[model samples]
Target: MLRRLAPVVLSLLVMVLGVTALAARPQRSAPPHTADFVVVAGVAGLRWEDVDPRTTPTLWRMAERGSIGSLSVRSAHRPTCPVDGWLTLGAGSFAAWNGNRPAGGCPQQAVTVERPDGTGAKLPDQESVVHYNQEQLPWGAVPGSLAESVRCSVAVGPGAAVAAARPFGRVDRYAPALPEDPTQLLGSCVLSIVDLGTVAGTTRAQREAAARTADAQLARVLAARPPHSLVLVAGISDTDRSARLHVAVADGPGWERGWLTSPTTGRDGYLQLVDLAPTALAALGRPMPERLFVGRPAVAVDGRPDLADAIAKPLDAEREAANQRAVAGWFYTLLAAVLMLLAVAVLPLLRRARRHAGPHGPEPVPRRVVAVVELLLIAAALAVPAALLADAVPWWRAERPGLTFAGVTALLVAAGTAAVRFAPGYGSTLGPLGAVAALTALVVGADVVTGARLQLNGVVGYSAQAGGRYAGLGTVGLGVFLAAALLSAGWLAQQVRKGWRPAVMVAVTGLAVVIVGSPYLGADPIGAIALTAGLSVAAVISAGGWLTVSRLAWAVMAALGVTIGLAVLDLRRPVGERGSLGRFLAAFGDGTGGLTLHRFSTSNFDTLVSSPLTVLALAGALLVWFALLQPWGGLMRLFGIYPAMRAAMAGTAVAAVIGGVLGGVALDVAGAAAALVVPMAALAALRVLDHSTDRTVPTSGRPRGVGSGVAGEDGSGSDGGGTGGVGPLGDGGPGGAGGATGGRDAGRVQPGTATSDGPVG
Candidate 1:
């Protein structure tokens, strides 16, 4: 008994140690933050491409001397406007005015300013903007929180005043424009913000002119004498009606010569606009008020030898992220369409096969036709992972990115499907499904353990522009992996002895969940919860016996235990260090859990209605319940014969439901998984029904893939005429599905593809 459990225990122990090492990794701590004075140069719509030595010399030099990163300006709303950007920066969290503004380039920066005294100004209407962000929006942003944290502050322009004003809309010191010698104004306070104005234009010439103007003002501001100061430059928001990565530079005492990053965005050299407030407050030695800030202080990492190259990574991401937003919608719609087409085409065939079966035997399905449909089903399942892997190539930079991406993805799906169709043990019914599921799991899992580079701008992955996740496995990716891994694990459990099946299922699924829940890997606590729930259900069912209320209770209890354990582990880390699960736990503990839930619920609702993935999820669900599980569907017999496969499908479905809601992206995660697996399930049902009444199934009377019948289960070949040419690829493995003429039994059955009239355990 001890030897039997040794592998599972050892494997689990290894994974735990790996997670511990990754989580305890050194947090980015800026060196003491000794600079007492902080200067924030707010440059709206500044891209790295716009920075030139001749036209924007000061900004160019600033990048060369400091830590540089691309800024993601996601505020309380989509397309963070200039005003929204300024307020978010001020509050150190997502905030939006939600005012009526032009749909295109932002309206000219405006604020109703009243000069209270010679050196002070007040924007009366600023109070309204603050009120709207706090009272109406999900993010409870206090606009002047940055100023209120310190004793005094200075604002140079209208935009600067938006950031520098205290909560009541009052600016301690304000100036309409930069003074020639601003030493006194800058030295009078610990913090100073200068708006370099919007750098934007439809034409190249106009942009260059605007760049020169902002550059001149920036140069003058830097010329002022202020000792022991930190200078920060951020292209704070999106403009021209598009969201793109903007420049972020910090030239200060401890922040020189490195990549700028923060814990909020696990990816190096990328930080959000909200990070600016914490950066300023940290430098000035001011405490960040709890619940008022959502960003962490920026830290510098020294790795990139060339600043231009480091900055280019985010710039490329900007392009790829945009391209994905454009192409992914079309891809999901295509996926849903294909799955629907499969249903339209397969349903009739399955019913026809079933209706023709008589007591003597079942009607013979042409092997050629069966093989083709099986091949098509496999191809369909590969689409989701193929799209994600397609991002490996820089197709986004092509002249026609949308077309190029489609071509690349189609080729990948074709190649992967061909490989799976012809692989060894092709005759096994679970062989093909298991192979594809394994591929899906490997692609998503390999990407995360290796830094999630593929997921950064992956078509099926999360978007930085969306601002929900900057790094770690995305909710969609999590769903895909969850379904694939559990299915593959189910296939594996069937390969072992019946008594050992549950142990194997738990080990495989649990390790995958740990990777998913780890702060350093999947970086999604909520996903872990979903995975845990799925794993518990799968392991329980694999132990044998049909699902009962008591069994369901046991699964739920196991999931709850895992959820609490993960949250506790994550909360041990510092604020912003915890992943999704930890953050939710912390919020709930502090009485803000309701707000977080509302925020997630709202996001989920939006995705539920707007995303095409919802159609795919519903399709998968419908197929599972209405078609496969029904008496007319014919797949119900397959489940009664082989409960392990049933366990896999059940677990994936349960996990998908939990993930769809907790993941905040609604059906996208679950939909991708369903799109991948449901087609495969439909294909299996067709295969089983095709041979249900056949008289040539060995007469062994042993249902294939049940109890001890799974190993060595021979699958019938697709081609009909030959005695036994290998499964789809050619020259079958012992029982490969192939050109079928006369095999030993004349009818090769997939893993449990044959029906069993005996009672299930």
Candidate 2:
């Protein structure tokens, strides 16, 4: 027994060592030099293509003379509102802000403010600070906006001025235009934020005209600044569908005229809004703060004109318009396919029930048809992962996302077909399902272990351009789908053998959960909780643990213990080192937990009602449940026949449901959880049907495999050979006469019988 356990124990030890080594790696050091001054110009809803030399010559010149790239300005939470974008820019972290209500009428006494560090503090009631109404103020501005600055920072215009002054600090606000020769103002402040409010107009024409005006203003500001000062002009929000991609241009000391490469994305010509603060700080000779920020500095990269043009081309009005339509069309198509598959699974049951007239069973489906269905199922299973891999394909870039999606799907289908045809035992009852589920877990788990490189560009993974999550398993991929894969794989593994097989399967499942849930690894708080609860329960059952009320209670307790323990550990880290979970706990500790809870609840409800994919997923889940309870009783019989397999399935099913519910309540979209439950339930139903049909026996007379005169001690052919008769194994009765009996008989083959050659019914 000890020898058998050695491999599993050693594998776990190696994984632990790897995680420890990752944790001990050296941190990024501070930059060697500081910029004389930093200039931040905010142009809300400005897109790269909007800056033409004809109308906006000054802005065009800036792009020509500086490093230019598309900026991802989405917030950490859902909706990715403008408020969230600006707050992320200020905080250098994924931050949240609920709009503030005036405490008192008129000038508003004691305004409430929320910060990215997950703290809420009431600002001192000063008339100068309370000058603007909530509309004039950026949606999530808190007290001490400029408090993050190490030295003097100045703000100009209503937007930038209010954001800088709201935070608890002394900020000089210039609502009026700057002086023509403002060398003193440029020299005194380390940071200067100028808000180009002309772009705030609602219409495209107005905004275009405003852009030209803002360009002239920017030129004046640039001329007034010292020569060595670093200047950044950015668009903080999306003006319209065509303007969804924000614009950023940087120039001055240590920066060259070329494309921008952000450490956050590791890609040239792309930057996130959260990267703004850290990059600014770095230019001011500050170390990249550990843990608190999610972005890195956007550095100048020369000789990448082609790459820059390719990245910028997608922002063109024509391309953006096409991509929007493609996204919507693709989603509906995928949803339709899932619905069609559900229909295919249920049609057979309905037909079987309708034809109750005779003993003639329905004609068997042809092997070719069965094979095709299996391949399609495999294709569906591989969809997300293939999408992830497709990102690396040069032809599959964002400019032609719809075509890329189709190409990836076709390639995966072909590969899955080849696997089914060439791989040994893949056509067996449990083979395809088990292989797909196991492979899915392995790919996703490996990606998490290796820093999610594949997942970073995964069509189904987190979007770098969206600014929600940069690394780790996303809400949909790891949070929902991966959890299901682990459970399904673990359950299928149990059906193959007993003893150490189940133990090893359970151990691997547990390890995958740990890797995906680790703060230093997967970095997903809600995903960690969902996977831990679901996989832990499934693992326990796979290892031969019962699901009695008491046992289930303990499993739930254990899952909760693990979740709370991890959260507490994260909370113990310094504020700068904490992830989303840590920040959430800090908010809870600061008496602002209710706000966070409300945000999640509202988002979940909205997603459930509004998302077409989520509605279809819910429908699919209901169909699976209906099929399981049908009078044919395939699911019920399969469970009774295989005790250990039954335990694993039941535990996993329960966990999936629970995890789905929790995930919906906590994540940005409820669809992620639904994605997990639907596929798992559907596959389990398919497996049951595949095995059950081959093992059904006649209700009267001698069974097919039993010898004609074989009799029990009762002097009858094995308990009268009726529906209530003992099975061929002489152990089970009635409903258990199918594959369950065959399985038992296979182990005790009698001589001079066909039991060893084929299934005994």
> What lDDT does each candidate get?
0.76, 0.53
Which residue ranges in model 1 land beyond 4 Å of their true spot?
1-26, 102-105, 355-365, 694-761
Error of 2 at 465 (Å): 4.9
Clash number by candidate, in order: 15, 7
* Per-residue lDDT over 1-761 for candidate 2, one digit per residue giving the tens place of the 0 to 100 score: 88667645753454344234323312333333548778888877677656777767877777777778778776544444444445456656555344443332112112233233321222233223323312233222232333355555666654454345434433443433466676666666787777775354556687778888888888888888876788899887653333255788887776767777564554456678777877787787765543345566677777646433643553542343334344544644584466557557645633342222235667656556645555555666555555555545544445667776667656865775566456755644344555655556666666777777665535456545545455667655663454445645554554444344444444555565566656545755565566556554654455443566876676687567666766666677655455566666776686656655655566567656665555545565565566654545244443433333445455444544554454553322234434433444444444444433222222345444432232211121222223232333222444333322332112323322333113333
Candidate with the greatest lDDT versus the true structure: 1
Cα lDDT over the full model 2? 0.53
TM-score of each: 0.90, 0.71
User: Looking at candidate 1, what is the lDDT of residue 218?
Assistant: 83
